[model samples]
Structures are given as structure tokens and as C-alpha cells.
Target: LHQFDPQDVNYNMPSVLQVSGPLDVKRVEDVFCQLIARHATLRTRFELIDSEPMQWIEDTVPFAVEYTKVQAAGTTADTDQDTTTDTYTRVNIEAQQLVSRFVRPFDLQAAPLLRVGLVDLGVQEVEQEAQHLLMLDMHHIVSDGVSLEVLTDEFVRLYDGEELAPLRIQYKDYAVWQQSEAHQEWMQRQEAYWLNTFQGELPVLDLSTDFARPAVQSTAGDTIEFALGREVSERLKELAAQTGATLYMVLLAAYTTLLHKYTGQEDIVVGTPIAGRPHAELESLVGVFINTLAMRNYPSSDKSFLD
Candidate 1:
């Protein structure tokens, strides 16, 4: 998909971390370099090999932190008290702009799809601590949410001068195991289960919208936020416990009920992401190990919530 749509930035996972007190820029850069050296996915790139798309992991990749120092804006003699607040605001704006620019599409054929940037906001007299914003951007092909957490934890450990234990296995080892004959048999069983589940004609959900459907599908959309109060949340949890179902199952039931009410569809299929790390060895590795699970549910007006 990335190869076809090279301009899309949707797969770019960007994160920002704020560091307080004094910071060593060189040490931070070294920490990033160590992280790349530790994780094989960090040095991976994709290209066509024998007419098939394949990933190649390089032994090493050059990495450096792009540092930017933000200067405080001039303050009038009368606004000395507001200088700290004003400086913070200015730093925030500059940091946001830098992140926006840093989050661009990556070339799949290029190794080290990761980019790091640091913004030094200097020291504030009120806080008496220097602040720095660290930005990390990586392609989704090489990393996922869990991988980002691993990177952050390892980064902190390295910066604090703690030695990390060598990994027993890398992502490449996991990939090799996935193609083994034993894994193939297990995968075939799963394939059979899904084939049986979706054998019949699937129902198409048709929810009424304000405007006519476009000729082509679009990634553009808007989001609305709503919260279930504490009482309702607790009640839902209690219901889940009583019914021996997870909170996710209970919430999914409610969501499907809403869809049935809106579209009058009895059968609905929804897709949700699942962490695909099945082995203990894969837990600490930095890689894209996520899979989508398709859930098919039947909701009827006559059935109670429990049913």
C-alpha cells in the first residue's frame, strides 16, 4: 500500500517526549544510535526482490538527532512576571511546527526509516530546570505501538547508564519461525476456522449518512468524543464480570446494538487490532507485530443485552 501511495503519511508513527532538568545532547544521540543497533527492524528497508517485495536489514544505519534551540521572545519591563508563561507558549508553538515538518512520508527502499529531533527550550527562571522535547518518527512497516514503548524504556535505561541484557532473539528469528512447517499446520487450522465462520454470504451494513457516498473511498474523517460516567462504567464492568465476558465484549455488544438500530442489519462484521506477539521472546523486540481480527455479530431487537 505504501509503494502505491508514496505520499501518504498515515503510516508515519510520530511521538514526542519531554525531558526535564539538564540534558546531554550527545548522550541522547548515542542512546538513539544504540537503540537502532539493538533492534533489527530499525535498520530494515523494503525493495523488490525477484518480483516479490522483501525486507532487507542492514548491519548498521547512520542516525543523529536534529537539534533546535528556541530563544525566548523579548519581554517589556512591565511584563517580567509573564515572561515564563510567554516563553513556554512560544516554545510549544515551535515544537509543534517542527513535529509537523518531521512527520513526512518515508521511502520504503531507504534504510533507517526513523528520524529523531530535539528542541531545547532553555532554562526557565521559575522552574529552574531546562526543558527539551524529543521527537521520534518511524514508519509503521518497521514498528508498532508496543515497539515504541520498548524503544522508550530502552532509551531511558541507556541514558541512565544501565546496561541492557542482550536479546535472545531478533524479529528476523520470529519471522523465520513463522514460516516453519509446525507453524504452517497451526495456521492452516486457524484458516479452516475462519473459512467455516464466514462461509455464507456476508451482510452489508448500510447506515444512512447526511451526504451521498463518494465514488472513491477516502481516509478523511472527523471524530467525536463522549464518555460514559463513572457509575455507568462500573455497572458495565459488573455486568461483564457477572456474564463471564470481558469489558471489550460488553462494549462491543453495545456498539453492535447501536449499528443494528441505525442500519437495521442483523449481521455485522467489525475489525479490531490485536497484538500479534505470541511468543515470550517477541515481547521485548521492536517490530510491527499487529493483526486485525474480524468479529461477526448478530444483533436482534427481540434479544436482551445478556442474550
Candidate 2:
């Protein structure tokens, strides 16, 4: 009980990759999957063990990694032989795969969360051309925004022969512990606090999202992503350090300020995903231990983005 640092969890979304280069795609994929399967949480699902969602782990999945490889319309170049593939891509819609519903495991499985598709770049003959493509798709449930970075780093380390350390806990334990930690008292307090803060605010943002969809349409919305560069991100970290506040607080403040300016509302409420993991054991597991809630902030004309 001296110190317990748990891993963060993420929502269930299909995380995808499009790799184009003059390389040995199959071998690269094989190595990638092998690295992921070594982690325990990636092999687990969630179960309510003792009134909490814990990692309901299995010995292994039938196919630890699901490979979806599609051949391109050209001669395949040898993979691992890095050739430039700096190309813009177009989007095509297809039916979402059922694997989406499977509880996403972390990279610690007997095999990585593997899916492969051979992309058809359709590049017909050219000079300065030695290009091939390999695409890997992973369910985002196992890959949090931060965990993406971790996965990349770990992948590189594995390829570079860096020795890996064994993780102490899996996602299954985290699931159960989370529920236990969120006892009636905590929920009551959280409800009271959130209720007071958000009760009187108007809606924020101009995204115009809908909470409901027709019965046939499963999901109601999509997402847009943008990142803050090092300079701004570091400034935020500095502010948080000085004020002894969390990044969550700062982000909430920024959203509030943005809303007040955009909506001309003094009080604004916005919803964000919160980690539902409360117990120490839950820190390491993967599952849907997240929820959305509205936050309220006051109106201010001069509130800067960083304020």
C-alpha cells in the first residue's frame, strides 16, 4: 500500500492505422501482435466480481489477434524495407465490424489486439518508387489517448530489445475494484456537487450534437480531434502546478470560457467523460469504466482560454 500507480482506461472505439512504406508488412504485424499479447490486461474482459466490475480474464481469446489483410492492386514490395509512402488518403465507408463490441484488452495478452488489411494504394509505376502499405486496426477501448503514446513507446522498446517488466495487476481486477470504490457515499457526494454546479447553466458549444438517434442508427455522432502543441501544453502544465489543480480542472475551465464567449451565456454546462475507476485495483484494468457528466462555469467576458 505504499504507492500504487494505476493505468488509465479508455472508451470503446476502433483505433486504426494506415502504414504505407516499402516494407515487409506481414513480419512487422507479427512482431507487433506478439508484443501486445505479453500484457495481461489485453487478454481480459470485465466481470462484476464482488459487486464491482473487475477484469474477468480468460486464459486467452480464440484468436488473440484478428488479422484482416487485403491485397493492393499492384505488385507487393517486401515489407520492413522502408520506402517512402508519403501519400494523402481518401475515406470510404464500410459496415463497422462486430469486433467493436468485444471488451478491448490492453496490450498485455497472449497476442496483441490484431487486425490487418492490405490496402490498395493503386500507385501505378513511378520513379523514386519503392512503396508498400500495412494497415493495423485496434479497438480503442484498450487504447486511451495517453495509452496510444505508451503503446508506441512500448512497441519501439520491444523491437529494440528492451527488457519488459511484468505488470502487477490486470484490467479485470480494476473493473471490480472501481465499483467498490464508488460506494453509495461517494455517489451521493458527487451527485450533490455536480448538481449544484450544473443546475442553472445553459448549454455550451456550437457543436449542435444530438443525444438521440433513430432505432436503426446505432450511434448518434462522430468525433473531431485536435492537439495542443508543446508550448501551450507546457504552459497548461505550469499553471496546473502553480495552482495545485488538476488538468481536468483546467480543461473544464477552458470549456466553460469557450462556451461563455460563444453562446453569450454567463453560465454554461458541458459534458465530458470521467473515469469511473475509484479503487486502487481498477487502475490497471481495461473496461468501460467511464461516464459522461455536465460541468458548469460562470460567465465572464474577459476570461482567456487559459484562465
Candidate 3:
């Protein structure tokens, strides 16, 4: 998807960590280099070989941390009183801008599709210590949510000078196994299941939108964050347990109900991600191992929630 549409930034995953107190820039840089050395996915790049995309891992890749010093936007008249406030506001704005810049499309052909930036906010009056922001930008082709968590845990351990256990297999090993003859039967069974499930004409979801649908699908969208209060959350979990269904199933059922209410359609299809790691060995590895599962449901007014 990225190779065809190089302008899309949806696949870019950027995260920021706030660091207080004195920071060792050299040590941070060395930690990132060590992480890249440890994960084959960090050193892997894709290229077109015989009209097909093929990924190859390099023995090593050069890594660097881009550093920026944040200063107050302009001089304030009340230097003593407002200096600290002004400096903090400037740091926040710069941090936002830095994150915006970091969330950008990556060149798939480039090795090690990960980059880091460090923003240095000079010593603060309250903490009396320097502040820094560590920004990490990675392409989704080589990572997912689990991979991020794995990277963070390993980063902390490596930074603390703790030794990590050697990995028995890398992502490339999984890829090779997936294409091997031994896995053919399992793959064929899965393929057949999906083919049989959607054998006929698929229904198109036509929920009302504020604006007319565009000619081409867009990857652009905004996120709305909300929290279901603790009471409601616990009730939902209880309901899931009572019904012998997982919390995800209960939530998915409610979601489909809402969609049915809006569209007045009985049949609905939703896509959800599943961690594709089927083996314990693949759990701690950092790579893209997520698969989308299309769930089809039928909602009816007469049927109860349990049905």
C-alpha cells in the first residue's frame, strides 16, 4: 500500500516520550543502534525483485538521533515572572510541531524505516533539571502495537545495561515458514474458509455520511477519544462473563447493534485486528504480526441481545 501511494501518512507510527533530568545523548543513540542490531525487522527493507516485493535484511544500519533545542518564541516584558511560563508554552508548541513532522510517509526502499528525534528543553526552575522529548517514528509495515510495546521494554532494559536473551527466530524466519510446503495445508484450509464465507455478492455498507462519498476511498480521518465510565465498563465485563462471551465479542455485538440502528440493515460486516502470533516464540519479537478479521453479524429488532 505504501509503495503505490507514497503520499499516505496513515501507515506512519510516531510516539513521544518525555524525559526529565540530565540526559546522555550519546547513550540514547547507542541504545537505538543496539535495538536496530537486535531486531531484523529494523534492518529490513523492501525492493521490487522480478515485479514482486521482496524484503532483505542488512547486517547493520547507521542510526542517529536528530536533536533540536527549544527556546521561547519571543522575549517577554516580565522576564522574571513570565519567563518560565513562556518557555514551557514554547516547548509544548515545539513538541506538537515535531510530532507532526515526524508522522510522515517513509520510503519503503530505505533500510531501517525508523528514526528518532530529541528535543532539548533547557533546565527548568521547578525541577532544576534539563527536560528532553524523545520522538520515535516508524513505518507500520515493520511494526504494530505489540511491536511498539516490545521495543519500549527492550529499550529500557538495554538502556539500564541489562542483558537480553537471544531470539530463537526473527520475522524473516516466520515469513519463510509461512511460504514453506509444511504450512500449505493450514493455509489452504484458511483460504477455503474465507472463500466459502463470502462466496456470494457481498453487501456494501451505506451508512449516511455528512458529505457525499468521494470517488476514491480516503485514508484521511480524525480520531475521537472517549471513555466508558468504570461503572459501565464493569457492567459490560460482567455481561460478557454471564453470556460466556469475551469482552471483545460483547463490545462488537453492541457496535453492530448501533450500525443496524443507523443503517436499518440486518447484515453488517466489521473488520477488527487480531494478533497473528500463533506461537509463544513469536510473542516477544518486534514485527508486523497483525491480521484483520472480518466479522459478519445479523442484527434483528425481535431477537434479544443474547441471540
Candidate 4:
């Protein structure tokens, strides 16, 4: 935000929830609204006042869940022109259009940076089978991945006609607590540790690349996935036990070791996310409660892998 404009309209978080079953549209809408009303963060918007930012919570946010029908393959009439093929092609085209809108940036000033859409999977009034695709688009400023899981759980419970207990405090209450004098003092106490940890000139990681690096950073990216075999996974567990450390710690040590071998830089700092919700009451709340902690590793050449 310090480097870019606040209203750039390029920052957004999107997720899709695929649900297959009997879908009650009215019930789902009511439960969705209840979910937003129960959580203050969902109904929050940011604004600049006196050159500072402040959160504005709306009493009610607009219901923006759109419903569209997607024709099922082999369900169309058997005409000479093959109506089923035509229907399938049309549905695929419409679905792509919906996906394009799903990634569009949201307006931060608009309260409730959430929009939902339901895609009917050939469910008609006379048909017995019912299913839907729940599309969700939200701004990262107001939420994170954890928020998505919380909402999904609540929606399922509400759809099952179960009552949810009222929250004692909301995210706004936490924000207010952060401004207290005691909190400021607590925050200051950690300054010395961070300062000492990052002392001296930071080393730049010169990664070996196949192509020239760009002058400006870009969000355009993709992910690759790989999995360790069962035997290797069990060995990793055994290694963690011998070292008296957790699996995560052992894996992190291995990662830092790999980086040290690749870049020949032992003073490595790796960033990992931690859930900032320390209180049990805040666990079920839907909000962005995460902080990144930099883990500095200085592996010695004399020590073994367990070290």
C-alpha cells in the first residue's frame, strides 16, 4: 500500500466452493446474509480520513448472489442437429464468462467485499436431482483463506437448521484492543529482538535463473506440486524425533539447508505464516488473523543434517 495507490482496484482474493446436493436457493441466501451479519469483517469497508485509514462497518450489505442455469450434457432433446451438443457448448461458454468475472478486482470502498454466485447444474422445478456451484470473490484486505473455511462451516450448519451461538467480540473489537496502551507496550517489547535478528547489511539471494529478471515485480505466477513417498515421509518423522523437533521444524531446516547448498548463503531468512488468533473465542471468527514470521537460519558447515 505504501508503494501503490489504495484505490488501484487490482488486489482481490477469489475462491470457488463446489456443492453437489439438494440446494435450497432461498435458504442458502438467508444463511449467507446471516453469515455476513454475524461477522463484522464481512460487512467492513476501508476509507481514508485525515490521511489515515479507518474501517467502516455497514449495518446491512447488499445481497449480490447471482443465479444462472447451466444445461447438463445428454439432457437436451435428440434433434437432427444434436441439441445436446449445442447445449453443452453453450454451458461451457457461459461458465467461462462467469469465471472471468470471478477474478475481476473489487472496490475497497464498497462495504462487504464479497460477491457470491450459484450455478445451477441442470436442476429444474420438475427434476429430482439438485446441485450447484458456489462462487465466492472477496478482497484480501478484509479476509484470508481461513475466513473461507469458517464461512463454509457456518453455511453448512445453518443450512442444516442448526443454531450458531453469538460471538462475544468481533474483529472490530480486536482492532480497538490493539490501540490500547498495554498493547503498544507489548509490541514495543518485541522491537529489540527483531532489530537484533536483522542487524547488519542484508544479503541478497542471487537465484540461478533460465531467463533475465524483470525490473519490476509482477503478481503473474503459477504453482508446481510434488509429493514425498511414504517411506521418505516416515524417515522424515524419524529424523524429527531424533532431533527432538517437530516435523515442520525439521522440514524447514532441510529447506534452509537446500537453499544454503544452492546459493551458498548460510544466513538465510525464510518467511512463514502464523495464525495470530491466540484466543479461543477468535478461532471461529471470519477475519484476517495472520502474521508472517521470518525464520533466520545459520547452518554450520561442520554440523550434520540433524543439526
Best by lDDT: 1
Off by over 4 Å in 3: 72-79, 125-128
For model 2, residues 141-233, the per-residue Cα lDDT tens digits are 454544444455666576556766766665545544547856657878977987776565355355434654345654446789999999999
Evaluation by lDDT, superior candidate among 1 and 2: 1
* Per-model TM values vs. the true structure: 0.91, 0.54, 0.92, 0.89
Q: After superposition, how far is residue 231 of candidate 3 from its true place, in Å?
A: 1.8
Model 1, C-alpha of 291: deviation from truth (Å): 1.2
Model 4 per-residue lDDT at 182 = 99
TM-score of 3: 0.92
Residue 217 lDDT in candidate 4: 78
Candidate 4, residues 1-307: lDDT per residue as tens digits?
7127644545566667767667888888898899999999989988889978888999998975788877655543443345555755776677778766666656678877888888876642224356567888778788777778888899899999999999999998888888899999988888888989899987666668897678977777899999999999999999889879999999998888888888888788899998888889888888888789987788767768876
Candidate 1 — which pairs collide? none
Question: lDDT of each structure?
Answer: 0.88, 0.50, 0.86, 0.79
Select the stronger candidate by TM-score from 2 and 4.
Answer: 4
- Clash counts per candidate, in order, are 0, 26, 0, 0
**Residue-wise C-alpha lDDT for candidate 3, range 163-242, written one tens digit per residue:** 99999999999988999997998999989999998877776788899988789988777999999999999999999999
Candidate 1 per-residue lDDT, tens place, 114-224, comes to 999998877755456787889999899999999999999999999999999999899989899999999999999999999998989998778899877787888788989
Instruction: Provide the lDDT at 216 for model 3.
Output: 91
TM-score of 2: 0.54
Model 3: ten consecutive residues of lowest lDDT: 72-81
